[model samples]
Target: MTEFQTQIQAATRIVQTVYGLSVEWQPIPGEVEVVQACIGGREELPIYLTQSGEQTLCICYLWHDDEIEPSRRTELLEAMLDLNIPMPLSAFARVEGYFVVFGALARQSRPEDLAQELAALSENALEALEAFADYLKQ
Candidate 1:
């Protein structure tokens, strides 16, 4: 198999083994391959992984949705930007309908590195949710 394919498979295995998480691959027509993993002990969060290109894979977890309540949109966005300031490794991204905390990894990245990224992403995402709740109150 090609290097990209090999790397993808290796990543899948590493995530499963390290996180005790199962990955479901879902490939869309004419798009890069995508995989979904439900993390947390109770499967509380869903993380989406997709190949960013031939050599990078993007790992993303839903952070928040600024459009949920139109009245607070501006405030919510500002809060999100504020939360982004001190964050390390991952950054907040506004995806199609939600804000996501995302980071990219080299296609051939080590399993431990992938695990660290996933752990950091998951932990920070949880913090962001709490921060968003506080932001909405302001």
Candidate 2:
């Protein structure tokens, strides 16, 4: 499996316990977080947020790989439709190889799902995730 696919699988097992929802990854939904033009691409990670032709939240990622050539963020954004990620996938950053990715799980999973998952935790986990979300401005 590719590094990302493996990371995703491993992340799923970890989040199932920490996030409380049982997520099953599926194809990227056509309507959810539509992949607008690529704002950028990187060998590390391309994380960008933009509005649709109608103002809305859309995100795009250009996977980090050694074999790819560098290109302008705008060029990447224009070609983004070809690099759609499953809408519900967790967004994580690996700093020094340790990750902090979580949430947006299961393209169809709702905030309520996360809320319910929080309900199962022993108060502290709930607060921790909440604090993190707060940091994300969610």
Candidate 3:
């Protein structure tokens, strides 16, 4: 298995036992956001976790056919880490029904940068941006 494949194995085990979710990891072409995918297009509610491990990160993905709700995604991840709060992003939509790509908020660090990049906002996204701003404000 590739190193990332190993990470997926470890992350999946860790997330499942810890968060009560079973996630299967799949590697997508291009960018590396580490998102979860549902089996056979089941609505399993995807979960993406970004945590700093060793030097880099072990971002974990868990998919839900109900669709991975970003708020729930962030909540699940933060809960596992016991983090106070987490950066959030909007959900993903399947263009062709075969797959859907979750919208990534930012690389990691400086959440405000993500807010800034979005440039505008929907009410919910705006709320998250406002929360991020509040985090920066503190």
Each prediction's TM-score versus the true structure: 0.67, 0.23, 0.30
Candidate ordering by lDDT (highest first)? 1, 3, 2
Model 2 misplaced stretches (Cα beyond 4 Å): 27-138
Please list the residue runs of candidate 1 whose C-alpha ends up more than 4 Å from where it truly belongs after superposition: 1-31, 61-67, 134-138
* Candidate order by decreasing TM-score: 1, 3, 2
The local distance difference test score of each candidate is 0.63, 0.32, 0.36
Best candidate according to lDDT: 1
Write model 3 residue lDDT over 1-138, tens digit each, in one string: 555455445645544454444456465554544434322222333333332342222221222334435446555444434422343443323334222223444234343332222221122233333333322212
Cα lDDT of model 1 by residue, 19-110, tens digit: 67655444434555665555546255656666654445455645446434667778877887887868876788876766788877776677
Candidate 3 vs. true structure, TM-score: 0.30
**In candidate 2, where is summed lDDT lowest over 10 consecutive residues?**
34-43
Q: Worst 10-residue stretch by lDDT in candidate 3?
A: 114-123
